[model samples]
Target: MAEVDVGKPLPAITSEAKPFWEAAAQNKLVMQRCRDCQAYVWTPRPACYECGSERLEWQELSGKGQVYSFTVIRQVVGRAASMAFEKEIPYVIAWIDLDEGPRMISNVVGCPVEDVKLGMTVSVVFEQQSPEVWLPKFKPLVS
Candidate 1:
């Protein structure tokens, strides 16, 4: 992992999401799973999105998925906040359909932005944003 851009916005670690961030720092991808319904929960919710069960536990994931949708960011949009990514204009942001059934939005890296396609297979790669934060970005999965 490389040093994060100082201008890049970092995630605020909430108690519910602390575990996920901690795991990412270890270069692992994990999500919460409901013990009662066997459903995977994302975004660090308080209860299962599927069965409304509060019996959730953190579990490691395969870190593999397919691009569900994507867009090439060619311009900086917002105010000061968007300027941080100005150097990374023309990056690809995509929704990935994980093998474990969760759809997560993350940046697709390790390849040309033009090469990204819908349903293209990808796997997780951590990018260190800070000592306690590592973002899970996706890259093209090599066979």
Candidate 2:
């Protein structure tokens, strides 16, 4: 696979999400957990999705999941946002359901697009785009 170039858009590091990204840079997957209801809040929100509590803590998770859904992007949409993937055309983007019960959208790497199947088990692999940014991608788990 060709290397994706620099200048691709990256997520803004806010105070609420800094820890999550920092952990990724260190090759660890972390998520926000609600202290009140024991719920794993996704997307790193300021308040818990289940209990509406401001008490949330960062917890590392086993980056393993199954593909809940997926699509093969055969073409780039010809927009600035999609330009980042111009060189990576015909890639598999998937919604993965982690073992911890939260879903994350990521690219399915290290395999052919046609091989990606629903409910296929996957494991996380970090791709460091820059010095501080590490994007979490997944690949099919070896049996």
Candidate 3:
């Protein structure tokens, strides 16, 4: 990917998050699953949130979901984000409910915040900062 901004604060890409970011680069989503209970979870934990088992693996997920709850940010907290998105004031952020049951936090794009509503269908779109780095963002699913 090309660097859209010469110097911007990027989210720390940790070892545990590599797989997810790489998958996102390929337009895929993945979450952790517990080997013991077959329960799926997020945040790339060392153990299952359901069964408390350290046995886990990364599993592919369908990148389809709907907005559960959301907030429109008129004021961004960070200097870098504020600068990068100064023209894009009032963006919608939300907890999207994936079809497989995981709720992921992401920003809703391709539409105005006033148009963004609860239970609106959304799909993932990746923001590539660098060739090796990618972040998951989303857009409304339009008919």
Candidate 4:
């Protein structure tokens, strides 16, 4: 995978989200799961959204999912922030429904933007953004 440009925006590594980013750096996908409710929690939240449980554990995921929804970005609107992605104007951003039961947003790559479709199967691919950060993008699954 190609490294992200230096000017591209990177995620802020907070204490709660450190593990998720760290796992990505090692080419693994992980999410927080509520020990009480057994529900997967996203965005590194301190409590489970389902049962409001404080017992969350970091668990590795299968990294396989299907596109739940998507949109093609054909334009760059902003000056500084958006310009960073000008070269990749036509890209697919989608909400992927993980096989383990969580919906997360990521870019769907490795194919033409027009080829992306709803319910398309996908798997994780990491792109190193910095020494400590690897952004997990997804690509269409190869059958």
Residue by residue across 1-143, what tens digits does model 2's lDDT show? 44555657888888889999999999899999998999998888899988799999999999999999999997766474455677787889899999999999999999999899999999999998877789999999998
Q: Please report the TM-score between candidate 3 and the true structure.
A: 0.87
**Arranged by TM-score, best first:** 1, 4, 2, 3
Deviation (Å) of 5 in candidate 4: 4.2
TM-scores of all candidate predictions against the true structure: 0.93, 0.92, 0.87, 0.93
What lDDT would each prediction earn against the true structure? 0.92, 0.90, 0.82, 0.91
Q: After superposition, which runs of candidate 3 have C-alpha atoms over 4 Å from their true positions? A: 77-82
What C-alpha RMSD separates each model from the true structure? 2.1, 3.1, 2.1, 2.3
Name the better of 2 and 3 by lDDT.
2
**Candidate 1 per-residue C-alpha lDDT over 105-137 given as tens digits, one digit per residue, 9 for 90 to 100:** 999999999899999999999988787888999
lDDT of 4 at 89: 74
Q: 2 or 4, which is superior by lDDT? A: 4
Candidate 1: worst 10 consecutive residues by lDDT? 1-10
Model 3 clash pairs are none
lDDT (Cα, tens digit) per residue for candidate 3, span 19-62? 88888879888888888999887888678889799998999887
lDDT of 3 at 76: 63
Candidate 4 lDDT over residue span 1-143, tens digit each: 54546677778999999999989999999999999989999989889999999999999999999999999988777674355687877888899999999999999999999899999999999988788888999999999
Q: What lDDT score is found at residue 11 in candidate 1? A: 93
